[model samples]
Target: MDAAWLNPEEWTCSEGVQEVLLESRKSSTRLTYLAKWTRFSRWASERGISPLRSSIEAVLDYLLHLRNQGLAYSSIRVHLAAISAFHLLIQGQMVFSHDMMVRFLKGLERLFPQDLLKDFLYKREKGELLIQKSKRLKNNLLKQMQLSVSKDGFVHFGDTVMLLSPENNKSPTENYPAACGNLTLAVNPDDITVHTSESLQVPCGLSAVKSVNPVGRNAFRILSVEGNSMGEPIRFGQNFGLGATGGFTDQMLYLASDHKSFMRFAKKSYLQQVFLTDELSYLTCWQATFLDPQLRLEYEGFPVPANTKVLITHCHTNRGLAVPRNYWIRSYFGKEYEVICHTYLDSHKAEEDKNYWIIVTANPSDDGITMFDRPKPPSEETREREKNELYAGT
Candidate 1:
């Protein structure tokens, strides 16, 4: 075989074809293609192989070599384009169209989930995609309506409502809903009752708490082991549980003590995920502490008011829950951010705004339930009236 195939300058192309090829692409692109083609030619020559008659196995090896050299998925595609163009010019063959080559590229994409282009692509499994869409639809329906409340005139224990951020409420013109955090927390085991693992902790799904809307996964039913507080006001510093409002699994927010589960940035603090365990241990409890951004202690031990900013710190770690704005993860719903529990200083140092959350009640009118209203049982007069009415009907 003539070594002419190893060099673009020695290609046995006619003058007319060469002129037409020059007109087909910009000078910059032609130069880039030629440069990339030269690299491949040199690799083939080192092995004493013909570049024009390269097999699928040979091309795969070359692509893998590029990947091993730290070339991104997009960069690999550029090399393929150059090789494909030059190979067609000389051999009139489509090396890139081979089934194996196509599959190899797809495999590369999956192997590197952090690829820049993967952000805009749908990388979730088919079943997960459907589940995400269904969850989104359910959230939309919830947003169209109000939350479920109790009769205590405040968001009582066990009331289900969406946790909205007060950050957007400060500026009417800003679109903060797009940056709202939604829990991607899930149960550790699908069936927690039958599971026998003691170290089983609830783990956050591939997606964190980041969400575009403040409903569905954002809705949670306030719970507590204190059954006496069921109809009472949800007070501050009280250990409570948060069960995700909509889902087949009983996913409740829990702070995993396992060192392996801590956030990468804040290693001392735990990453906030969901637990599916039926046990009401301290791990699943969190406290709505009264540390206001303004440095006020006026609301300590008071009922958690609606639309009022409050700090939610994990009871186990005493670290405040936060969502790092810069760190993001791709999900079936879209790009989402990670939610973590950070050490005291990391959570509240000058950036405490990220730690502030509002408990939005589902009540339509503000007069119906005010946080100032102290929860009380029915009065004796009202009880007597009810008794008389029952006797009269008998």
Candidate 2:
């Protein structure tokens, strides 16, 4: 970026100090770029393709080739940046600035992630493309992690973790796994329990090795978890099961207050099954136990999570971290209910409030749409009344 390094092609012998500095920078920059450019050239030539004048697909194929070689994210960035610089050297600008190219680079960061939280767009079973929304919180950049890039470059997005971990960002260099807000942790009964503060969403991994079906446009498999023998439809069931009972329920709407014992575990320092959070926007309106605020006299319907869940297992060990946050609230129609537990494994996080909704009843109306009441926290006066009542009763 320096003026002296601008003309990286300048190869010269100099006697003066400034001249020597300029030459050294030029040589170093040129050498570094030349090596990367040559690699691309050789790669293209081997495949009988052009490097600089290549099409977007060609360039993407080259990137995929590098990715298949197990390149680190930083290293891959350097390669692409080098290509951009190469084009700038000849064309006085960049070749990788197209919208498709930009998306390709952006997709690389998520498709090939440095941590647990990932984002990308994938085509669903019905041919609808869904974009997964993921946030890179501050916790992502502060962990001590050692990444193992396998030669196959195949990352497992199906891991379900129960991290009852504290929000400790003090150690930036500890050998730990990168934390994402949502993850698909393996719920094995034999694995040792790990307690961390991060509960990442790991949606279903659709592969030929495992069961896969084209259902929702979301990025996960719909596992129908039930309460009182309720279940949701899966791709396999929808396509194969003519009258299967496990595949007919909805994945978005949750039954509130079905599990009343959630509050008992909420207060424990270690037990964190039902988390009390004020961040309602993390999920769709229908996914919340209370009424959704987005509903209006002007608007037509409510929103829902891309994925949803209705039940979870309460355990004392590491499995507790995998439990979804449960909430009990009153609907606008004056009905009291609790939203079902939406664990990280449930694809509900991917469910959008647009068009789709969670129908919590077995026999919903012709239209499963309904209005909800706005939610409000308990007032100070109410808290005082409860406190006084508790003292008086004691």
List all candidate RMSDs to the true structure.
18.2, 24.1
**1-394, model 2: which lDDT tens digit per residue?**
3332333444343435446654543567677877888898898889898776666677778778888887765566668766765543333435567667778878877775652121112223323222111111112312222211112221111211111111223243441332212222111111111112112212111101110111111112222232212232221101110011111122221111113354443322223223222222212111112122233222222221212321122222212122221222332212121222223322543222211222111111333121111123599999999999999999
**How many clashes in each candidate?**
1, 38
* Top of the candidates by lDDT: 1
* TM-score for predicted model 1 compared with the true structure: 0.43
RMSD of 2: 24.1
> Which runs in model 1 stand beyond 4 Å of their true positions?
1-146, 150-153, 168-215, 249-278, 293-298, 343-351, 365-394
Candidate 1 residue 135 C-alpha distance from true site, Å: 9.6
Residue 289 in candidate 2, Cα distance off native in Å: 81
Please give the distance, in angstroms, between residue 48's alpha carbon in candidate 2 and its true position after superposition: 2.2
Would you list the C-alpha lDDT of every candidate in the order shown?
Answer: 0.57, 0.33
The sequence of per-residue lDDT tens digits that candidate 1 reaches over residues 237-356 is 777777653332433443332223434333222354423344567766777866554543566677876555677777776766665444555543455555566533434454355566
